[model samples]
Target: MSTGRDITALVRPPRSYFVNAPMGNNFGAAGDVATQSRILRAVLALAVEARDPGLILDDVLQWPAPFAFNPAPATPEAIAKQLRK
Candidate 1:
């Protein structure tokens, strides 16, 4: 459910909404207010409803079309090594 492998989920803490997104734009696509608000509301609703701890809301926003991103190189190790520099 996590976008970038949230280590915190191992402990299962409060206010955790695991989504399929990048680091910054966790809720929805940047500049897309409607989607953002909707995501926020969903999380808020979970927060309000959740009584016990260890609540991880794993949800995926149904994007209209494919949300595109910069293509990654075929090999991750090569790109990761370059980024480390």
Candidate 2:
């Protein structure tokens, strides 16, 4: 079974999922670091405010590291280069 299916199978009883679209998509036309950060913070706040016991599949939370790049790139190629060693 696929990892996604495995995960889906593990979710029992009450289940909740949280997902953040790619930072670029979340930011929209003029998406920037500030905008992306704001959206991420909002999602975190919601998860914290939620009182019920449920899973939150927050993709942003799984980010390898924090967003610290200055003058963020505008394309996938640029972003990939930035992530390289």
Candidate 3:
């Protein structure tokens, strides 16, 4: 078993680095090398710093700048339409 899609919530990983960005480009925004490295380092550091298991730490940086992302479903019908499609 455990061959299907790996759900995020279900899989209790020992260490997790949650980013504010989308699933596509979570490390950084576009070509932001600095931002990417920062995130990576933080995650790597967690491996050593983290003593407890199954800990999910949120990204320290709160992404301020707006980047092109999938807009949230505004209406109930819109949400249903997306689910249907």
Highest TM-score: which candidate?
3
**TM-score rank order:** 3, 1, 2
Off by over 4 Å in 2: 1-17, 20-31, 55-85
lDDT of 1 by residue, 1-85 (tens): 2454457577666657777766567878879998788888888888789886876777766655655557666698887988989
The residue pairs found clashing in candidate 3 are none
Global Cα lDDT for candidate 3: 0.69
Q: Using Cα atoms with residue i matched to residue i, what is each candidate's TM-score against the true structure? A: 0.60, 0.30, 0.62
lDDT of 2 by residue, 1-85 (tens): 0113235446732434333332445432243577557656766666577666554443343343444326654798877888994
Residue-level lDDT of model 3, residues 1-85, one tens digit each, is 0111134337867767777665566786788999989888988898899987767777866567755546675899887889998
Which pairs clash inside model 2? none
Show model 3 residue runs off by greater than 4 Å.
1-7, 64-85
lDDT of each: 0.71, 0.47, 0.69
User: What TM-score does prediction 3 earn?
Assistant: 0.62
Worst 10 contiguous positions by lDDT, candidate 1: 1-10
CA-only RMSD, every prediction? 5.3, 12.0, 7.9
What's the candidate order when arranged by decreasing lDDT?
Answer: 1, 3, 2
- Number of clashes in model 3? 0
Q: Judging by lDDT against the true structure, name the best candidate.
A: 1
